[model samples]
Target chain A: MKLQRELQIVNRLGLHARACAKLVKTANQFESDIVLRQNEHQADAKSIMGLMMLAATQGTRLTVITSGADAEDAMTQVQHLINNRFEEDE
Target chain B: MLSLSGTGIGRGIAIGRAIVLDQGHNDIPCYRISATALSGEIERFNHAVDAVRADLKRVQRNLPTDAPPETSAFIDVHLLMLDDPVISQQPVQTIQEQQQNAEWALKSHADTLIDFFEDIADPYLRSKKNDVAQVVGRIMGELAHSPGKQPSDLATLGSSLAEQIIVARDLTPADTIMLRGRNMAAFVTSLGGPISHTAILARSLGLPAIVGLHDVIDTIHNNDLLIVDAATGTVLVAPDEPLLAQFRELQQQHLRHQQRLTLLKSEKAVTQDGEAITLLANIELPEDIEGLRSAGAAGVGLYRTEFLFMNRPKPPSEDEQYQAYCHVLRRVEGPVTIRTLDLGADKQVDGGRPDRETTATSALGLRAIRLCLSEPSLFKPQLRAILRAAVHGDAQIMIPMLSSLRELEQSLALVGEVCAELEREAVAFNPKVPLGGMIEVPAAAVSADLFARKLDFLSIGTNDLIQYTLAIDRVDDSVNYLYDPLHPSVLRLIRTVIRAGHEADIPVSMCGEMAGDPAFTRLLLGLGLRHFSMEPSQLLEIRQQVRQSTLAGLSGQVTDILNCVETGSLYDLVDQLNQTDSD
Candidate 1:
């Protein structure tokens, strides 16, 4: 299952590599497997290395894909994570 | 002696010999080590690790009690990486399997660790990789000890480079602390900004530093003497005598200005005719309260609540917020005005709802008061915390991004409700907590009279006011030129707000980037704004400017400038005012 979520890069320095990895890591915590696609490129949601290599800057559009029995829940969690910039404490 | 010019972040002049402190031999080499010779390398690596661990413990013991947590954490991570089985054992195994030298194995391992950290993406955690590399480098250097080369000797080498050293790359907190009090004349780095630890350390130490030099290393030779003017971010490479003489004069002038600033620290911010204008400081962190007290700030005009919201996963708890506020109140004898989080649509808090319609044009939308109303859960706790802390200090709560009377009423009702709940619980708090509103939006400014009647005071947040009034995002470099505070609209709005505040017999202040600037000090003073809150750095200059000008005279000149259509004339007027005492 694929869902579109709009996230603004609110961090003053923008969404650099580390922030992307965090999003991916948080997305991977759910049972469903996740894939994040930015613009035309897509990468594994579980692989922090793959997510950062995409270099999604702050204020970029990202689409998350989840597959498994809990795909909907995974998508919701990922969407919520992106909405909050993966939580400030992280 | 050669001099180079670059942006100056910190202030001070020093004459010293040139020293270059580079993160040497840390970069991973392409060549892989063969499987043979691995056991000896592993043994060497372990020995180095043990040595580094001991050194870290020593440093930790000696660290200052007030040192920033980041500094201590860096050393802690160094110890962790040294102890991590994944880091310690894997590299040794790889070196043995690949038959590679110690440097190759260390670099390869460091590369892997960097990759791991880079993938994590959190700034704090990502920065930790530097600590990892530093540890690994120490281990490698120990193993490859070119007879007589010691890790301790790096300090001596650093001191040697400190004299006339043009730091071409970013310096970590450790590097900065090590270089303190050395013959280090100035620091020029390829990375970092005014907020970086290195920059802050340089400021405290009175060292001249220029950051964001971008390839400044390639511009100068190893021994090429350079003069760094950190005040202007200019590095002079082999400067001629005339330029040197001019810089020396500028340095003297700066020193004189600093001395005058020091004198003003003890003096009241009274005008020539004996009008005492309260000079305050705007603080973002609780740590900054010390500087404010030292600077003799009458009070805190603005304590930005956004710092608590930013870069965190969850909103700071009510207890966390109270402690932070109470801490500031205890440190300063003056009233503290805490602005309820001024986060706009752009600054989204972690776990907070995102404003879907917000865009480049959405800065004015769903920010401050709007966000508070939309997310009452987030806003209520903060309101309760600020009010609770008010009993402990002269705390006043100021709402941000308020454009309507309705928003003010809603916020006031909420605060009233919180106060009642506290009363019912027998919680100690000042029931009559002075509530204020920021006149940042044009609507707020225009309706300042109404707000002044309802609110206790008004703080004009010029950064957002200018942005919203001009219809240009200050962050947008393309339209940055349009973000002029001197624009007719902004000035007119400011005049209106000041008038309204005065009419209601309520105090008004400008707590924005413009407030600290000496260039606009007289103009704001003339506009009937007696209260000024700015960064501590600008307090002295602004106070000095205030001392030199009479409110009546400055007001007349400002009115004249405001009425003039010549855009260039406004600057001319300011320039004239700046040079008035001199002439």
Candidate 2:
């Protein structure tokens, strides 16, 4: 059930506190181990502080890796959230 | 020995011991822990973390429904940070592997985290370092104040904060709400302005506050005697005996002035020419009834029902709302004007109701009466509750933000439907409860005659009326100077609403900040406004102003003020109206 994909951050403010909070909340909803990797920097998807530490700005591409029974579903939601720009009007 | 100054909220003074909170990280004790005592130290650290987590959860759970969305969002980030393994686990490792004390270990990890954030190129992300520091500071505060000390001393530390003046870099809305019930003497903060939540809360609670006192925490230590002169926006720390005695006398005089005002509580609010004024109190919580009684107010003028709907997972059921409304209804002696859910703009509630979420910006969006009408599940329970609660006492329903006759017609229809449903269920309710409208929206004020013919009474909420008319957000500190209540347009609207009430033979009451302000007391009386509802703390002061005025002489001055073409002279004219010897 392992899945991996490259996703682009489309939101203008990138991963700010509110954005990170939204991402972490969505990632915590599934049983998958979600992680994001960007240029040798990796962050656990469930950790807001870790997501913030990546300093991923708009247009930055990150590789998402999910592994668990619900890995595919988690990956789909994570992709949808980023594609929708975290529901923010940027 | 030291002095600091800031903007003061009120003209009150307080003398109390300092309780410095969230001080900078230069003073943390870093001592070597014995090998055998490591487990005890680790246990103490764990307990402090758990205590802080519990405290944060409690604050989140009890958040006022009207708190801005950012307040909850900020707390959520801090809560998530607390759960992150980097924060929760790394400090434990530092304590165990490096044999460092708990405070030292946490500070080391926090510094590392802060450095990582500081290196981020984005300015917004760099500010996240402050969040890390604040989270760590909370834990540090808990450690310094709680369990590691002797058990008997723990009780004293916990109970003594009520008497001390809180000094901090700044206070969040959550912090202010948590401190609201405590009998704290005053607040001195390093940041904030007149419109900040801290200042607003202090004014509502009738306490003195000094905000914008930069780096106040560094100079004031715990248990240091200090004098907070809010009149001059000064904090005198560790003063000598002579200075202390001088301030003590001043504090006594300030208190005696307040005591003197209380003597007017039982007196009627009437002009010298035999015109009587109805004075009422605006309240949010049922406990405010205590102040209403103490001030000898006529009754609850505007009882805000939003507190019942905020900070919870879901809206209250019909029975629950009924019980809450009845609790306030049975306690009050006169008519209670309970405004329906004015939940929009900055006062949105996060009670898990999805319908309240709108795409438009809050100010001009679907809120108040519009939101209620669109969502019957949200509106009907409140209507049914207010009707049922009216059996206990004189309760009236007031609708807020009604703009046009179409909305009024729809609102009346919905009320009719609720009445039919309640009657079908054989609910013991009073259907004769008067329905009033808050003339806060500009359109409603302009069409006051039409609305007055339909509604039973009209209450002018000047806060929103002024904001809507001037196109200025009162909370925005940059533009607040332009929020003049004496503006010609604002006065004309007030006059229009009052005249409509007089023509329709109904009472027009004002329940805004303008009504409570003593300077505007005579001006409002001159404009034919006889009913005034304000904060209970201001009731006696306004009553004294009412008793000293002669209504027979105000009409000519008011006519001059209304016809005033120049803006600069409007204030002078109002000041002259307040002068008893001028006429």
Candidate 3:
């Protein structure tokens, strides 16, 4: 199964190192292969270097693609993390 | 002698030799590897990565339970980088395809990642390159088999570096955490401002640190004798013998002074005449609570809430403010006086409202109670939060810079309005929480008796009161010398406020720099300032002074000091007052 959705980075510091680490940790938790695409740049969601390379600042929208048996759960969890501003205060 | 200066973290002095941490990025050997040697080089690369992983994990496992979650999260980022295919597999591909040495291949791949981060537009995201460099640096150190390049090595060389100052380009959170449990004398970093991780860690640990000393790592070397005076942010290298002797003497005196003050921590802040004085802490950050606890303060007298509202794009929500207030309330044992939003003036809140920007530029402009009164959307949430958080402990609201009875009435009405709103929503709040005012404005100080009648308590903010009474901008170096706290008008205003609080039967506290000054402790006591609030560090020192004074004998000298015509004579009288009071 495969699913796709777009989410915005809303945290104050954007997808900085820690936030990227959080995203990668969440992505690696499932069997799904997750990839995030921001504009022309696409990166494996499980790669902190890839996410950092995208340089997604606050309000940058990225298309997230999850494909596997647990695609639904992965999508749900990834969406929740981004929307929660990576659990950062402000 | 050569000296470098930067912002100091705490009031500490250390004399030691220096040990510089080279981030190990300067030199890299680029060379071709023979086919057979290429495979061995790749294995060597894998081994280094694994070693760094174990080292980082060891540091993580041994972290103090009290370390902030961010510290672990920081190490997690590097750990994840170690596992990520971009970092782990790319260098192997480089070694296999290019037949390059492991160090050269890894450095090339790491440089690509760091260069990508550098091109990012956002400054914050751009700085994330440091994390990548730190992780790569660790692996590089492992590959080189250098002993002291890795921070984990600090633990292994603990005894040798124990009496030496650590000079680093910058310290990662993990480095700081590892250094915390060590007996390193001080830290001098080539990078970082006052709010950086190194600065915060040094302050919390009471370790002397000087940061933002650019190129300091290159300037100092291992075994270079050094003197660190954090009070002046000075790091002196190889001072002359006579100057070294002088500093050694000063260091001894400082140690003796701190030891003497520490002995007074458990003693009550009461005069020799048997009058008990309340010595509370003026807290700006949550970290200050530790200092307050160690100093044995009565409670938090002025909890500045402006810090919550500043440095953010939007004002904190009502829930956030309530949680923050409750955090302090639960930690404190006695009354915690939460000062309402004192933003504007010099403290410009970034995203509060673009329209209010112009008004916030001047000291006398729309600020403090004025700004809060004009913007109910900004003010109501704080009012509601304080009222609700009051349920958790003895919380009191103290409004700042209340210059008139009309503003006081408007503030009170807003509080009432907030209470009604909370009631409508059926929220649990302390409706009877004490409401106080800061008597900083000369007008408010003059008419403090009237305001005292309407308020629960009053606190004299002598810093602002002295600044305004003397019409001097304390920040301006030219006129600050004239900014005298002992000016006749300033003394009269303080006296008036104290007398008014006495007559109105309300507690009057001084929550300014003056309250903590031992020179003025007796003077204020003579003028009847029974409640004092100051920085947590000053509490014990002030307590020592308070324990030696008899208020009965001070009154006569205080009157003379107050009536003295010349500033010179006034200072002389105060000196005489302190001289006679010494047991």
Q: What stretches of model 2 exceed 4 Å from their correct place?
A: A1-90, B1-7, B17-161, B166-178, B187-200, B210-226, B233-242, B352-361
lDDT of 3 at B287: 71
Pull out the clashing pairs in model 2.
B65-B310
lDDT of each: 0.70, 0.83, 0.83
True contacts kept of each: 0.00, 0.68, 0.84
lDDT of 2 at B505: 95
The predictions' CA RMSDs to the true structure, in order, are 19.8, 15.9, 17.3
- Predicted candidate 3: what Cα RMSD to the true structure? 17.3
Tell me chain A's TM-score in each of the predictions: 0.74, 0.98, 0.97
**Which residue runs of candidate 1 sit more than 4 Å off their true CA positions?**
A1-90, B1-253, B344-362, B581-583
For candidate 3 chain B, the 10 contiguous residues with the lowest summed lDDT are: B146-155
TM-score of chain B, candidate 2?
0.75
Best by TM-score: 2
Better of 2 and 3 by TM-score: 2
User: Which tens-of-lDDT digit does each residue in B30-50 have in candidate 1?
Assistant: 233324434545676677777
Instruction: Please provide, for model 2 over B77-138, each residue's C-alpha lDDT reduced to its tens digit, 9 standing for 90 to 100.
Output: 88888888877778887778887778888999899999999999999889999999998999
Give lDDT tens digits, candidate 1, residues A1-90.
Answer: 545555455554344444554565566577777877777877676654455445565666777678887888887777776667656543
Question: Residue B438 CA error for candidate 2 (Å)?
Answer: 1.0
After TM-score superposition, the amount by which residue B369's alpha carbon in candidate 3 deviates from its true location, in angstroms, is 1.1
